[model samples]
Target: MKAKTHAEEAAAFIKDDARTHWHDETLWHVRSNRDRSAQGIPEWETLRDTASATKNYVLSHLGELLEQFEANAKANGVEVLWARDDKEHNEHVYRILQENKVSNIVKSKSILTEECGLNHYLEKKGYDVVDTDLGERIIQFAKQTPSHIVLPAIHLKKQDIGEIFHDHIGTKKGASDPNYLTEAARQHLRKKFVEANAAITGVNFGIAETGGFVVCTNEGNADMGTHLADVHIACMGIEKLIPRAADLGVFLRLLARSATGQSITNYSSHFHRPAKGKKLYIILVDNGRTAQLGREDFKNSLKCIRCGACMNTCPIYRRSGGHSYNYTVPGPIGSILSPGRDLKQYSTLPFASTLCGSCSDVCPVKINIHEQLYKWRQVITENTNVDKSKQLSMKVAGMTFGKPVLYDLAGKMARTALKITPKSLVYSSLNVWGKHRDLPEVPKESFKEWFKKNRKQ
Candidate 1:
């Protein structure tokens, strides 16, 4: 099957005008809340600066920090494992479960696991895997990947979830009440929590100094699953590490406020060691992060705390929906990160942004997301096979703009063409930009001509 391009997927998302508008407005509301929360904190910018600088130091000293983390984690009775990529990570997880004689697994919301396709791999091996987070569980029941990172099923409405719950969990067909649905999910997940042989969680932050990891969640599912399960596995990318335990305070304050305008996550559970008779494993996966780090322009993206603030503030992401990006992580950050993984396969992702700079403005870690996106576009254009039309158009634009006389002549020609051309021809199938938007009325003369006339007067 041929994959849909970002444009096609985005078009499909926007076809439902009502849903599109709702998604845009909902994310903007979250962005608005983030603004209010940041205003309440006098030191918000300081926190961002500190967090970014701390992450930069961690990236530079990653090797020593990982070794230090490993030694201390071993001292704390926590097994630290390293995986160079997703395949190795999945194999390590499967081996742990197999060695433990595990059958049923309950996992909290872990974008790393989703990136590794852990559930699908485990399910193919015949182990029953259930996602315990409410948003995750809803999408699990729907047999769909998360549309958003923090809000997995944000694309779905209450009624959509009600329908899904009805089919899978025997809720009443017409039930759509938020409270009733939440209670039903709680009841459904409690059984899974008790029955799980193993639990997996995504690390929000790992402290190299103490060799402890934090998993922040509002639902407390990570705590419940790990508390009940015999084997607990926490997966994290290599970039999730911080140099010191105290450094956690800066990120924790920025994370929730930037994500959902909350003071903090309800449960910021820290796991330093395994409980008695229980096993704990931490898998630090690279999965192309090292290669990304080598790219000076893009390495700062690893500073991301996965707060989804960039997504909430992104104009394109809000309208196109997360699934349209066709990656585990979506939106501006994803646009910058995806191209690094596979330049050809993900070439279109970098172009999805409007380069509005809003994403970078709202980023808690202050990653230069928009700037990296522009750099990726330059890289992609030079290295990959872009569309012939787009290539020709860009070359023409470059030539026209390079010479002032050509530029002015082209502007004058465009004004004349717009005035005389029929609307149908001006907005024909070839004019992709004109499909959704109408061209502005033609001016009487070029700005250059008007400026030359007025300057002398």
Candidate 2:
């Protein structure tokens, strides 16, 4: 929140060169593991293509599919709720809790809830909501949003978390050992799971054919919470629908391996019907997703299965921590998605990428993330009310580019100025790009000049 642009915030992370390198290498290692797992599967690309096709089908037939899902789910004794937006979604959840007379709830990892700001909204409304996922629980206690959607606390060092746990949950001071801290969190969260009167989970995929929803997790917390609670609620974006149960085979194959290098999550739960003697609700949320669907360039974003592979492969994301992007879902996909929601606040996001396209290569669902980022940049720059400086700079570049003679002259002048400029002034406040990075030396000749001399044209 303190940093306005991606560059400004990414600078803070880069200043600690050691931590930045560690973050970069850590994610690169995850990417390597993904490659290893993907190599073992002969049909990985085929699966990706099929997944994309499946999502395309669902997006095209969402209304019909969702109505079938609703009818089938009701026949199976599950109540279905449709929320048009975040405000209505949160209000629906609040009303459900009030109906159940429950003030305390245990929730598994759900970025949809985070997107809706439901935890904060419910807390302000006097209900106690406990995040059960280890990463979500850590960030929740820290009073911070998830740095990464899948690995929510990736930005926090174990030591930083040690300090937090020591203050909030009474871990021994200076105890940052992974096994010890995990055990402590386990003991603490186990009690909450038992005491919570209601539970919530995010749907990984909603099956229209069977009226069932899948919630995949490395931890078995979703099952534990739902089975223990009297009221269970599952929240999902309308985009999660995939039409049939057999389609899970393709997605489940790609999800965990791309996400964290596991063959699959330790738990791939199918909530076909509510737990015995318990009430269940599924809130199908349409939070600007319909609008995003209307955008042909960006509609592929809805195909994302939340595998987080794109985040691992993105060079910019690896160097700049997730918090740098200042969105619920950070990295390449987030950059493309956030601008559609709030252009004024998130206009900087689409420009955060280097257009490397590694994200599209690694996506489980083939979102074409880097292409979308590039497209979003064009859209935001042309359509949004951008700043005066950006407008003026674009205008100057456009005019100069339109005239070959002027461009050549301008290039010569820039090279001369760089050669003559004082070192102090070159790195001073006047040079924004050079403030954090050293300026490159001007070449003796431009490419055009070199080509002309070499070819004797």
Candidate 3:
């Protein structure tokens, strides 16, 4: 409850709800939907393969494609800005608001904005930014960062939101019904939407061929907010570009099914050109993403559709929960991606997974998430400072198993020592496995010894 940073919050969630079963089941529910949806399409696997190839092609040629996208977007009347980092990104947005003298803005759910800390930056610059999405609004009022990319306030119950509303909006106490709470949010956001001069949204997909951005939403908040505002801004990662418009068909089919098990989202607004009398802008953000793309093995992560399917399907993610990942994008995807930014700080996340490939199987873009998590561990241990105790233990373990004779002798000695040791020592802090499950019974002899005796018999 006192978690100030994303990592701290994630750790708190895992420790607090150790007994909760639904955390795992909640993800599995989405995974089941994903599996069913993928099965529904006969060419789903082929489609995923194609999407991966296309994305890789685009990333490899990103420099040229970005310039082309910018030129085409400008021709279509959408101003394009390139931000090298978070500070530049924030400054550009702030300057845009100041240039128009617009004070109020409405934004749909945007993980990019969250990543850049855009809301806080704008607030400090003296702009009132209202989150139009219901879940986003809930977390905004609570002064908390979104726990999940797709569902900002997924961790909160209706009762929890009811409390937030009562405190922030003076809604009648004890009104915990979802319908009433949603309507209250709608009315409040409607006033902001009408009064706002600009709206910002996150692009789900950006078609490089035609210079258009796509926003997918179940609530239709993006459409309404953009339509009403005088200016519109679409925030996107440079990696969001697809080679062509038809390529979106492949991603669109996989996005909803992998995300929430729906055939398609309620709305898929394709903004190829700006609306009449409205100014449009696109901010292409490269916050540690370009560096991630440079890595050969980890680059495939760029193809992620931001679908929660991987988290839903991961055994560790389900048990430890999304918040345990300790980043904006939680679950399997976040664990692999978070380490790219701060290798030492978020090192524990990659190790948290059980190396299950369910995440890869469910991924729309085929990111090979489990494999990437493994690769990150080697990178972190080699290039970064690991805990002293862990380093010493690993060194001792390497020495013990470096030679076959030494390994066998050490194994026998270990079994002998285990026989005489008290259960307390076996179950003490020395054993990480014991904390989670019963200690396995040590074998009397090596498997090779047993095999030799069995062959003689």
Candidate 4:
């Protein structure tokens, strides 16, 4: 079966008017809260600058820092492993579980694992894996991948979650209260936490200087799972490292504020060493990150802190929904990153923007998201096989735009057509641009003609 493009998926999402509006408003609310929180801090911009600069330094010295981090982590009794890609990362994780002789696993929110399809891989190997994060668990029950990176189940409503819980976790048929549902989830996950043979967590920051990593979460599920399980496995991309422990202060300040408008995550648990009689493992996975770092135009995208601020502030993303992007991470940032991994599959993603620049404006780490999106579009057009209609149109547009006389004639012809053409013909299937919007009212005369006439007066 042919895969649906981003536009097709987004059209389906927009068909549900109420849900689409609610999704847009809810994300905009988060974006508004982010703005308010950022405004409260006097040095918010400074923090963003510092974080971006720090990440830039890390990218430049990534190999040296990773080595330093591994040495210090081993000194602290933590085992360090490296994986060139997703397959190796999953194998390393499975091998650890196999070596520990465990089958049941409880995991906190880990986008890296999701990117690698770790849960599916482990389940196929006969190991039971449970996602303990509330949003993650919700989506897991729904058998859907995360829509928004930070808010995994942002596409789901309280009513939708209540129904899912009733079906899976045996909640009341119509229970929709936030507190009630939260307590029910806590009770359910408590048993999983207690019985978990191993716990997996995603790393928010890995300090090269100290070899300690931080996992920030409002629910403290990562802390609970890791503390209870005998084996703690942390998965991180190579870009998660910072040069010094102090660098954490800058990122920590920017992350929570940009993500959920909190001053800080409720728990910022740091793991430098394993608890006595327990095992700690860190998997540093490359998975195309090295290639991305080598791309001069897109290396800055690696600096993303996974805050989802870009997603929140993107008007196109707000209207289209994250699932439309069909990538592990979605929205403006994903549009740029996805094409680098698989250009043919994700060629349309880069064009999924208005080039509004709001995404870059809201990014905590100051990644040039909108600019990169534009750059990716240019690259896609030059390298990929674009549609014949689009190609011909662009060629005609190029010729017309390059010649002043042809440009003026085309403008006059368009105005005349708009004045005489029926709405039905103007907004036909062929006119994709006018499908959802009305053309502006045509003026009686072209601006050039009016200017020429008035200048003589």
Candidate 5:
């Protein structure tokens, strides 16, 4: 089956007006929480500045810090592997599993694995990987991708999840109580946690100085899976690294606050060393990150803590739904990150924004997200073959706007046509805006015309 583009998928989502409105308001509530939390902190902006600076330094000395991290992790008895891209990364994990003869694995909420398509790879290779986090597991059972990084099943309602569980895992049919479903999922995941021989997790922060990593989860799934398994593997993007242990403090404070307005995640589990007798494996993934880093305009996108604050605050993401992005990590952050991976596939993403700058203002690391989106548009327009009609329209608009007389004449002509044209013709499929939205009522005369007649004396 062919996948739909962002616009097509979004068009489908907007067809469900009730769901769209619910999604928008739900995310707005999260954004409201974030605002209240940030307002509670007097040094919030200062923390953002510090976090941004630290990431800048980390990027500047990335090679050296990576080396330092590897040495420290090895010294702490954690085996470290570097994967240059997704193929190599998946291969490395598969090789590790084969050597160890691991048949089943339990995983926490790891967006990295999702991005790399690891579960499908492992499943095809005859390994059963269970996503232990409730949200992740729900989507896993649904055979769908995560709608949001932090809230994987945000696109789904309680009734939807209840029905899914009832159909797939045998929860009571039509019982949609939050507590009941949570306990049902808990029991189900607990069994997997006990049965799985290995566990994998995604790192939120990797400290280069200490050669340690941290996985923050509200569900405690990371700790549960890691502690019970004989072998624990942590997958991380190269951008997850920080220069020092103390820098972790700066991020931890900002992360949960900006994400869901929580002061801290319920379980901020740290993996400084492999537990005694249990093996630890760390896979540091590149996966086109270095290439993105090389681009001066977008390098700062790596500063993201994956708190998903931008997605929560994004107006388009709320209305369009995460599936619209057709990406693993969907929303504003996804739009910025996805285009770098495949410009042809994601060319429409940068345009997904209203350029309202809420994402930039809400970002704890100050990534200049809106500005980057603007720059990406210019880059796309310059490098790619734009549609002939769009190109001609831009040229005409540019020419008219560049000359005052032409602009005035064009404005008058446009208003006159709008007023005279039949409603059906004026609001036909030919008008993109008219297809979904109402055009403002045309005036009988221009504002300039009224000004000259009434007040020019």
Candidate 6:
């Protein structure tokens, strides 16, 4: 499939995805797990509080914790590398492969890899990197970016995948059953898993106390890929560290439930040392994360577990689709995180929300997402290169509303203009409102005017 721009692709996916009754049902089915888990726990709220506080504390002392983690990882015979950014990350991985003369590589689900364009980057360098996670593998073969974080190709129906496999991998046509399609991928990936010399996975939780990494997956892909390959590389962002194994218990209890509505993930593999005869490496990537950690209002975003609960519950995310945010990690999490990377390019992301706090309520770590959205708005406004129309309108609105008399005059003028302007102005160019709603009719008299005349009489 040819690549499409983010906006065009997101619009198309949202329109096409709305027709799938199964999509909504699937998410709700998973969300039920969160409800059940919460009901069973008398102190679910307190657990969330602890998790949030723990994460905040870690971020506050990240430098010291990172040094401790590096020392531990090195002591355990794992090679450690710190990447300043995406290019550095890709180059570091590439150098490892080049130095080892490694060609074929197997990878488990790592959104960090996707964010760094790892697969495509390695492919360009003539190394074949195969995604072993079923969801990721499907999207890889389709040459599409993931629409959702957990279920990368969640938008694709079995029939669509069947067609993709038929054309790309020579599966028989018209075999659209999910079980059959999944089995086909499993068999294909299994061969790659056994044959590839090197494997790479993303670290879900990096324990600073032990200097180890956790990789959670439902399908056992990370374990399978890491154990079978001669060499393994696990990538983690600096912000993913937690202080202790005990702290992981609180997060582990809430992560799967909030994410996919499971009481616990099928596999939560913690790797402290490389398995015998396997070469293990861990790459800690910064890539704008340290800058995000320094931003007071947005720093809490680092607590995200990549469960994608925010996107699943977000009305704007469901309606607009992930690519609309134009970041690897989409939805509310992406909105706050993307701005730290390039404020101007991702300024539209924070605006994609409706200021709903569902994302926060569902967050296992309890990030104040709506507050971050509001903070991003302020930062973008102060940057002085806002879209021209928005800049002009903000200037006029600020000037007019700064004075009570000018505000009253402007309101009356707007009322008159609303009455006389052709409906086309309110109907077409401004059609985003009209598409889903009707503008409220102007009152016969202004509320302010009526209240002034009638209040004391």
Better of 1 and 2 by TM-score: 1
Q: How much lDDT does candidate 4 score?
A: 0.94
lDDT of 4 by residue, 282-370 (tens): 99999999999999999999999999999998888889898999999999999999999999899999999999899999998899998
Residue 134 of model 4 has an lDDT of 98
Candidate 3 lDDT, tens digit per residue, 1-457? Answer: 4324434444466665633465556667777887887788999889888988888788899988888888888889889998988888999899888888787899999888888999999998788889988889999999988767776777777888999999998888989999999888888888988998999999998887788889999999999989998889899999889878888888888888888899899899999777888899999999999999888988888888787888777787666556566678877889888888887667777877778788887887888999998999899889877889989989988988798888888888988998899999989997876766886788889897789889877
The candidate with the higher lDDT, 2 or 4, is: 4
TM-score of 1: 0.97
Tens digits of per-residue lDDT for model 2, 313-354 = 898999999989988899999998898898878989988888
TM-score of each: 0.97, 0.94, 0.91, 0.97, 0.96, 0.89
Query: lDDT of each structure?
Result: 0.94, 0.91, 0.84, 0.94, 0.91, 0.85
How much does candidate 2 score in TM-score?
A: 0.94
- Provide the lDDT at 424 for model 1: 88
Where model 6 places Cα greater than 4 Å from the true spot, the runs are 1-17, 20-33, 395-431, 440-457
Q: List the residue pairs that clash in candidate 3.
A: 10-323
lDDT of 5 by residue, 160-191 (tens): 99999999889999999999999999988888
Better of 5 and 6 by TM-score: 5
TM-score of 4: 0.97
Any idea what lDDT model 3 has?
0.84
- As a whole number from 0 to 100, the lDDT of residue 113 in candidate 6 is 93
Better TM-score candidate (2, 3):
2
Candidate 2 global CA lDDT score: 0.91
